[model samples]
Target: MDAHSAPLPAAAMPANGFGRFAGHLDRALGGLVETVAALLVVVEIVILGAGVMARYVFHAPLVWSDELASILFLWLSMLGAVVALRRGEHMRMTGLVSRVSPQTRALLEAVAITASIAFL
Candidate 1:
């Protein structure tokens, strides 16, 4: 299945005024980040390919490509992290907790989140 078919995270659920606005904001930011990350992948590939050709085929190295690629890669990874978190893909604990009672689920979710943060 395509990534677009995946279910949305809890943050995107319906809510009151402020919460609804927050959800929209979160989704908008996620889309923007995802778009930029996709674009960066294309750009990094083009830059690296050109750099390779310049260094080998033409006997001239593109010194700036390495640094540029590194910075873009860092940004891509950070954006990916943000998207993963927004989509609740940061942990598998939720899937297991979902079968339990609400109270127990809440407690487990909190513990899992805290543990994840501590690990980070």
Candidate 2:
């Protein structure tokens, strides 16, 4: 292949050095977030179930159970959202995006992201 057609060397590629480091950091954080989210779901289930059992079956309601659940639910939800964002699973108007040309689609995505950030 001619020089122009040849693939760039690893050292010369854009995705090396800091880009590669950032990619690895992103994957590591994503995996950690996913694992934490999954664990939170399980813990929440267990806490709620035990709380119910303690209240109904044993005739002694756990006074702090609801408060604990509320706090955990908030954390779990945030972690779940983080996982979704990292995995690109957040809500999107895919039908609208899919119908557009590539250039338009890119522009639409950029606009969507900017709007989301600004709204935040």
Q: Which candidate leads in lDDT? A: 1
lDDT of each: 0.79, 0.78
Q: Give lDDT: candidate 2, residue 61.
A: 88
RMSD of 1: 5.1
CA shift of 111, model 2, Å: 2.3
In model 2, what is the error at residue 9, expressed in angstroms?
16
- List TM-scores for all candidates, in order: 0.67, 0.78
Residue lDDT tens for model 2, 1-120: 222223447677466578888768877998998888888889888889989999999999889888998999999878887776665666778778778787887788788779878976
Let me know the TM-score candidate 2 reaches against the reference structure.
0.78
- Residue 5, model 2: Cα distance from true site in angstroms: 27
Q: For residue 37, what is the lDDT in candidate 2?
A: 80
For residues 1-120, what per-residue lDDT tens digits would candidate 1 score against the true structure? 223225767777776888889878877888998899899999999999999999999999999999999999998888887777667675465456657787886777687779868976
